[model samples]
Target: MVEYALMLAIIVGIGWLIYNQTQLSDKINSVFNNAGNLMNDAASKSAKPPTT
Candidate 1:
């Protein structure tokens, strides 16, 4: 009985870790996407020819 309980606890812990890591990965991806967009916008603006 105790062994079964221990196994269950380990499974739960692994599932929790996986869930948290997935959430963190999504947040990190969003941050990088935003940064890329900002960089692209800046590059586009700088590419325009200067006007008097």
Candidate 2:
């Protein structure tokens, strides 16, 4: 009975840790994507032919 409870606790703790890590990775990915898009936009704008 005690072994079962300990196993359950360990499983729950591992699942929570995995969830938090995934969330953090997603947030970091979003930030990098936004930064990359901004850089691309700036580069494209600078490369456009100037209008008379």
Candidate 3:
């Protein structure tokens, strides 16, 4: 009985961790995408002809 209780606790803990990580992963992806967009914008501006 105790072993079953312990197993349940561990499973719940792992599931919670996975849920948190999924949320965190999405945030990380958005941040990386924003950084990539900023880099692309900078490159586009730099590639333009120099002003007089």
Candidate 4:
């Protein structure tokens, strides 16, 4: 009985950890995508030919 309880607790803890990690990964991906877009925009603007 105690073993069953311990197993349940461990499973719950692992699930929570997985959930948290997935959320964190999503946030990191969003930040990276935004940074990439900003960098691309800056590069394109700098590459434009300057008019007199």
What TM-score would each prediction reach against the true structure?
Answer: 0.57, 0.56, 0.58, 0.58
Between prediction 2 and prediction 3, the one with superior TM-score is 3
Cα lDDT, all candidates? 0.94, 0.95, 0.95, 0.95
Clashing pairs in 3: none
Cα displacement (Å) at residue 1, model 2: 39
Q: Could you report the Cα RMSD, in angstroms, for every candidate shown?
A: 6.8, 7.0, 6.2, 6.7
Model 4: lDDT to the true structure: 0.95
lDDT of 1 at 14: 97
Query: What is the per-residue lDDT of model 1 for residues 1-52, given as tens digits with 9 covering 90 to 100?
Result: 9999999999999988987978977888999999999999999999999998
Model 2, position 11: C-alpha lDDT score: 100
Report the lDDT tens digits of candidate 3 across residue range 1-52: 9999999999999988987978977888999999999999999999999999
TM-score of 4: 0.58
Report the candidate with higher TM-score, 2 versus 4: 4
Q: Which residues of candidate 2, in runs, are more than 4 Å off?
A: 1-22
* Candidate 1 error regions (>4 Å): 1-22
